[model samples]
Every structure is written in structure tokens, then in C-alpha cells.
Target: MRIIDAHQHFWDLEANYLPWLTDKPVNFRYGDYDAIKKSYLPADYRQDAQEFELAASVFIETEWDPTDPLGEVAWVNSLRKRESLPSVMVAQAWLDRDDAESVLAAHGQTDFVRGIRHKPKAASAPGDVVPGAPGSMGDPAFRRGFSMLAANGLSFDLQTPWWHLPEAADLAEAYPNTQIIINHTGLPADRSDDGLAGWRAALMRAAECPNISIKISGLGQKGKPWESAENRPIIRDTIEIFGADRCMFASNFPVDSLVGTFSTIFNGFRDAVEDFTPGEQQALFHDNAARIYRIDPTREV
Candidate 1:
């Protein structure tokens, strides 16, 4: 099917995104985007999607850039100069900032800046919910910042563990107009502690929120000995419960590539979506992104 990867990330290895790709001791640079140059860019991602039909990709923020909050926005802006790259961007922001409205307004002016991701962790450590550890998203100040998102015509890409369902739910209720996408299946929860049932319950709740959407991404496929076939079900269940209109497909790319190939990841996403009709597939892979992000594929920029 024709595809529009709703959630992917790119890091210019030799440019501004390089510093964030350091070793684990200092930074979280371990076989991530920059390290895997093959399918991390428009040209490369397109080439990598040769096995499948990937028409475009939405580039999400790799991480926060302290010196430049607009670093990801700048990256996509630069790409627009070079190529018709990264159709959309889910950039980062200090949601706790009082100037959050202006911050989003400025960034939203950038052609590809379509969404915001403030890391929030709802699970214990050893889980994939790093960056913002335990209860960072629960802060009321962050909720206030989120309130301004939809007003500026930007969506919020939520990256919290499944255990943080109540918190994610609260954010959705608080900002009824804002669009929130559950990142990485609530980060897979803690396999040893929270267990699948708890995560599943949280996911079921996430599906209920009208303003909330879930991106079917296999980025968190590993952390276990299972293969794509095994991991596909969790994401598939999410889609099946959430339904096609509420669900979208994504690559999560290099981060996911650490677990499987780009094609493999997309294929896993495709596999989960196999039951979806052709039109449903279109919605999942292309139209959903275009509609939700208000993507103007014909726009020159």
C-alpha cells in the first residue's frame, strides 16, 4: 500500500543533530538515527522504502536540544531547502514554559512543524519511557502549556508509558481541542512489573478519548527475545481496538531499526494493519497524516 510514515526521526550525523548522538554515559547515542544513515533521511528513507510504497514520512524530534529548542524545526526547515523532505515534524518544547504559546506559535510558522513531544514517563525504569522519568507529565504546568497547542493549530505527540494512562487521559480531558498521539504503545510498560494486562488496560482507555490517537509503530519491538510477528500483535490489538480512524501507521525508523530493518518495521506495521481494508490502509498510511497534520503534499515547501 502507499505509505506515509506518521512517526519517524532523522538526525544529521555531521550537522546540528550530531551532539545528541553521543555514548550512553553522557548522551543516548547508541545505534540510533545518525548511526544508521541508511534510511534516516528523505532520500535514504525513500530508498529504504523501496521494498514497500512509502510516499512520505513525518519526522518526530529525536530529543530535546537545550541550546536550540527549535533544533528539530531548523532541521526540517533546512531539508525543505534541499528537498521536499519530512512532510511533517513532531518537534519538542518545554511545555512548562509560560511562553509556551509564543514558542509554539513561532515553531508552528515553520512549514513542517506540525506536532509537539514533551517526554513523559508513566512507568518504572528499565522501561522505554526515558527522557522524562516518573510523573514528569503529571505537572499541572505542563498541562497548561498543552492547552495552547491546538489554539496554535499544532498537535501534541505524547511519549509516555502505558502505566501513565490516567495521566495521558487527564491531558486529553484537560485539552479537549488538542490532538494527542500515544507514542510507542505507551512505551510497552514494564514487562517485569506493570505487565501486559495493565498496559493493555491503559491502551483501552487511551482508545476511548476522542481527541487521542495512536500511532501504530513497531519502534519498541525489542527488549524481548520475540520477533516482529510477536510484537505486531500488541500494536495490532491497539489498532483493532482503537479502529482505523483513530489509528495511524509510523516507522519510528532508526530507533526501531535497532530492533529490525526499516522495511521489517514497516512490514510489521503493515502486518498489524492487514485486516484493514484498502481504504483503511490508505487512511492509516497516508490520509490520516495528511488530514491530522493538515499536510499539503502539493505545497512547494
Candidate 2:
């Protein structure tokens, strides 16, 4: 099937100081991430995704040098100039920064930047209801920074764990005009029945806001084995809660690669949605991402 990978990352270890890849403590949820610590540019991504028909992709910002957020954006745009695969950019920004407006303005000046993903989650105890810095989202300054997105014509890519989905719902309600794309299926970190129940309920609440759409990606981040049958309920429930119109699928690549191959991830996604009609499948794999990210038409997959 044709696909528009709504969420992927392309990083150059030599050009940028990515703490996650270099000599610094990383906050990734999964273990043994050493396998993917090397650079992952568009060429690597294309090779990984070659088994499937990948129409386009969006370069979600990786953890780069926060000192120069625009630098990472420029680097990715430069890559796009060479390879047209990653057709959209979701650059990084510190929403709580005092000069966030200037940063947002800088990001706005870029050609492919369609959104901003301010890191929201902070390290927290396992089984903690709200992981990450809970107050960051509601902080006056952060909200101020978030408020600037609509003015700059950019959407928000929320990367919070499941516990924060309720607050995300409230944030979405507050900014009815601004688009909020929830990352990682609301990040269901807990796979237990009770955990899934909580995630499902929170997702339903978030979906109540028409402006909040969910991107189904990053499922294997928490050390779970990549299996389509195991993910069917999560995928189906997310689509059921948000409806297929407000949902999109992504390869989450490189990061997800730590757990499984590109074919394993995308093929699993394809299997999860096998019961849906072809049109619904089309939306999950391509149309929804293209429309949400404002992807330009390119050569057909």
C-alpha cells in the first residue's frame, strides 16, 4: 500500500550534537538503544522503507542541540533539497523559552516546517500517572509559546505519555483554532489491561476535541516486541475513538528500528488495519498524513 510516513527522524551525528547519540545521558524509554545511535539520514530511511511503497514522510525533530533549534531545521531542509522523501518538517522549539516568539518566527521562515514539537515529557517514576514535568504544559510561559503557533501558522506535535492525555484534551479545547497532533497513540506506556483501559478512556476524552488528532506511531518504544496482532486493539481503538478522519499512521523509524525493521513496523500496521475498507486503509497510510502535514503532491508511490 502507498504510505505517507507522518513521523520519522533524520539526524547527522557529525553535523549536530545530539545528546541521545553522543556522550550524555539519554531519556529514551527503551533499553539498549546503542544499535541506532549512529546517524540516520534520508538514504538510510529510504533503504529501510524500500520494502514498502513510501510516498512521502515528515521529519519529526530529533533531540538536537537545543541551543540552535533552527540549525537542525536547516540541516533537515538541506537533506530535503537532496532527497525529496521527507516532504514536511516538524521542527523543535522550547515553548517555555522567554524569546520563544523569535524562535517560532525563525521556524516559520522555513519552507517545509509545518509544525513544532516542544518536548513535554520529563523523567518520572515508573507507573507514575503523569510522566515528565507535569506543569510544563500548563505553565504560563509555555502556554504563551503555544499560543504563538496559530499566529505563525504552525501546528503542535504533543509528545506526552498517556497520563497527560486529559490535560492535552483541555489544552486542545483551549486552543480550538490551533491543531494538536497527539504523538504515539497518546503514548500508552503501560500495556497491562488496566493501563490500556486508562489509555483508551483518555484517548476518547482527547478525541472529544475536534482539533486534536492522533498519530499512531512509536508503539515499540517501551520494549514491547513488534507484533501486529498484539497492536490491533490499540490501533483499532485509537481509530474508533478519534475516527479514521482524525488519525494517521507513521513509521516512527530509526527509533522504532531499535525494536524491529521497517517492514516489521509498517507491515504490522498494515495487518492491524486489514479489516478496514480500502479507503480507510488509504487514509491511515497516506491521505490523512498528506492532508494534515500539507504535503505537496510528488511522484506516485
Candidate 3:
């Protein structure tokens, strides 16, 4: 089947400055990531995804140097001009920062940039959530920058844990025109019964917002291999909550390679939804991402 990977990344550690990869190792959610610190350009990604028919992909910001947000976009533009893959991109924009307006304007003018990703401040646990904290989603300044996205014709890529979904729902409601794409199924790392229950409830709240969509990637667990039996319920629940039209599949490659091979993750997704109609499956694997990310599958990327 044809595919449009909704979320993936490419980085050149030597050519660029990615603090998390290049600097001293910080604690990572997916365990040790030293295995993938090397450059993963278009060629590396193509080799990993060769088993699948990948029509295009959405390049997400890889936490590049915060001081130079536009620098990442410029590099990706150059990469796109040369490689012609990652059909479009979601650039970085720190919403609460002072330079948000100028940075967003620069990204808006870029032809290949489709959206922006700024992971809002999240509490360590659900109970610790402090609403309207300085950099939290409810912060007035952050919302001020967020409001500017609609004018730029750019969507927002949100990557917070499920506990913060209520805030996400409110943000979506406040700015109905700006599309909010939830990354990693709300980072559902806790798989216990209570954990899943909380996750499902939070997802339900976010799903009520018509402007919100979700990418079913980054579901890998630390130290565990990707398995359909373990992930099928989460996959099925997400489709049921958001419906196939609002959901898309993504590899979260290189990062997720810590848990499984490209085929392991993509094929696991296919198997999990085997019971759905071909159209629904097609939407999950390809159509929804193309629509949400504004990627033209027919374009020669």
C-alpha cells in the first residue's frame, strides 16, 4: 500500500547542532539513543524504509539549537531542494519566546513549511499540572503567539503527554481555525489499566475538538520490541476516538529504531487495523497525513 509517513526526522550531527544528540547525553524516554546519534539523512531513511512503498514524509523539527529556529528550516529547505523527500516540514517555533513573531513570519514565508512544533511545559505527573504556568499552554504569552498561526496558514504540532490533553482541548477550542495535530498519541507510555483509562479519557476530550488530529507514531516502549498484541488496543482506541479521517500513521523513525525495525512498526500498524475497511486503512496509512500535512502525494518529492 502507498504511504505518507506523518512523522519522521533527519539530522546531520556533524553539519548541524542538535544539543540532545551532539552534546552530553541527557536522559531519553526511549532509553539509550547513542545507536542513532550519527547522521540520518535522506539516504539513511530511504534505506530503512525500503521495505515499504513510501510516497512522501513529514519532517518534524528535531530539537535543533533553540537560538536558531530559522536555521533548521533553512537547512531543511536545502535538503528538500537536493533530496526531494520529506515532501513538507513542520519547523520549530518557541511560541512563548520574545522572537516568536519574526521567527513565525520567516517560517510562514518558506514554501515547504506547513506547520510549527513547540512542546508546551508539562508537569511531571497528572496531579502536578499547574494551569496557566508561565510557559504552559494556558500562558497568555504562549497563546498570543499561537493565535498568529492561523494568519500564516500553518498548523500546530503538539507533543505533550495525555494528562495535558484537557489544556490542549481548550487551546483547540479557543483557536478553532488553527489545526492542532497531537504527536505520539499523547505519549501514552504508561500501559497499565489505570494509565490506559486516564489516557483514553484525556484523548476523548481532545477528540471533541474538530480542529484536532493525531499521529499514531512514537508508541515505542523503552527496552521493549514493537509488538502488535501490545499496541493494537492503543491503535484501535485512537482510531475509534478520532475516527480514521482524523488519524494518521507515522514511523518516528531512527528514534523508534531503538525499539523495532521500520517494518516492525509499519507492519504492526497495518496488522492492528486489518479488520477495518480498505478505505479506513488507506486513510490511516496515507490519506489523512497528506490532507493534514498538506502534502501532495502525486508531487515528485
Query: 85-126, model 2: which lDDT tens digit per residue?
Result: 578889999898877999999888777899999967543533
Which residue runs of candidate 1 sit more than 4 Å off their true CA positions? 17-19, 23-40, 121-135, 189-194, 219-226, 299-301
| Higher-TM-score candidate of 1 and 3 | 3
Model 2 misplaced regions, further than 4 Å: 25-27, 121-135, 221-224, 299-301
- Candidate with the larger lDDT of 1 and 3: 3
Backbone clash count for every predicted candidate, in the order shown: 0, 1, 1
TM-score of each: 0.85, 0.94, 0.98
lDDT of 3 at 25: 73
Tens-digit lDDT string for candidate 1 (11-124): 665565444455343313222344454325667666666787666677888774654677667767788677776777888787887667778888778767887888753445
Q: Which prediction has more favorable TM-score, 1 or 2?
A: 2
Highest TM-score: which candidate? 3
| Every candidate's CA RMSD | 3.8, 2.2, 0.9
Ranking by TM-score: 3, 2, 1
The digit string of per-residue lDDT tens for model 3 on 141-184 reads 99999999999989999999999999999999999999999999
Clashing pairs in 2: 122-132
